[model samples]
Target: LGNQAKAAMNAGDLVSDDLIMGIMAERLKEDDCKAGYLLDGFPRTIPQAEALKVMLAEMGETLDCAVEIDVARDVILDRLTTRRTCSGCGEIYNVKSNPPAVEGKCDKCGEPVVQRDDETEEAISNRLNVYNDQTAPLVGFYKNEGLLLS
Candidate 1:
């Protein structure tokens, strides 16, 4: 799955729906999910949402709600682009909000804190375009299903 995902991402595409649904189906069978689970950044498309409905129905369950964090694209771009991660400790910092004590250095491990390749302005802009084209529709889909919580 990692290889497939990497390939897709490298090609500037989302992972195939089949791969995601298969993983989700198996994951939902886990003991912890029998009660309930909080899924984030999933069901990004209407097809996936429908697949989830079928999957949950097969398990004799139903979705309660879908939460949407409606952030503006400019805000997302600014926030994500400003994020820096420690190479050693994986600590996250934001240049605009919570910069490291020593600029470009991690306080925890003294490692370089750098912006991730995927968090670059170009990369984030491309991701925002993809989200608008593909994932944004899910908001209306969930709303029509009476499952949206914005």
Candidate 2:
């Protein structure tokens, strides 16, 4: 699921249920996951969680826990607002502390580093608002199932 999500994110697309489920199906067949596997950055929405539940049920498995990384909205906004990306290599950097070797330049490709329009405070705030409104319920959903750990 992490790989699928990373691929979708790198392709500038939203991670969908089909992609995540496909990844999970493939992973569950592997010997390493026969016992257990820890999930990170998955089940971002209720629908995705439900899809994962169905897949796990078919596999005779269930989630043991779900943990939330608690961070303040202001900190998230600060981080997002300071984020920059290499125009050529797509390497992300933080302007606040992790600036490139050459200011406003890509350390890997020496290309100019640019702030994405979506990384602006306004855009990030809007995205956070939507996430809180639409996806925050997953916390309660997991809690109700006694799977929420933090």
Q: State candidate 1's TM-score.
A: 0.89
Cα distance off (Å), candidate 1, residue 148: 1.4
Candidate 1 accuracy as lDDT: 0.90
Model 2, 1-150: lDDT tens digits are 687699889999977778878987887789998878887767778988899999999988899899988889999999989999999999999988798988998989999999999999989999989889877889999999899888
lDDT of each: 0.90, 0.88
TM-score of 2: 0.78
Q: Write the per-residue lDDT of candidate 1 for residues 1-105, one digit (tens) a residue.
A: 657777888898868988888888878888998778899888888899999999889988998999888898889999999999999999999999999999999
Please give the distance, in angstroms, between residue 147's alpha carbon in candidate 2 and its true position after superposition: 1.2
lDDT of 2 at 21: 80
For residue 46, model 1's alpha carbon misses the true position, in angstroms, by 1.5
Identify the runs in model 2 with alpha carbons over 4 angstroms from their true place.
1-20, 30-32
For candidate 1, the 10 contiguous residues with the lowest summed lDDT are 1-10
Q: In candidate 1, how many clashes are counted?
A: 0
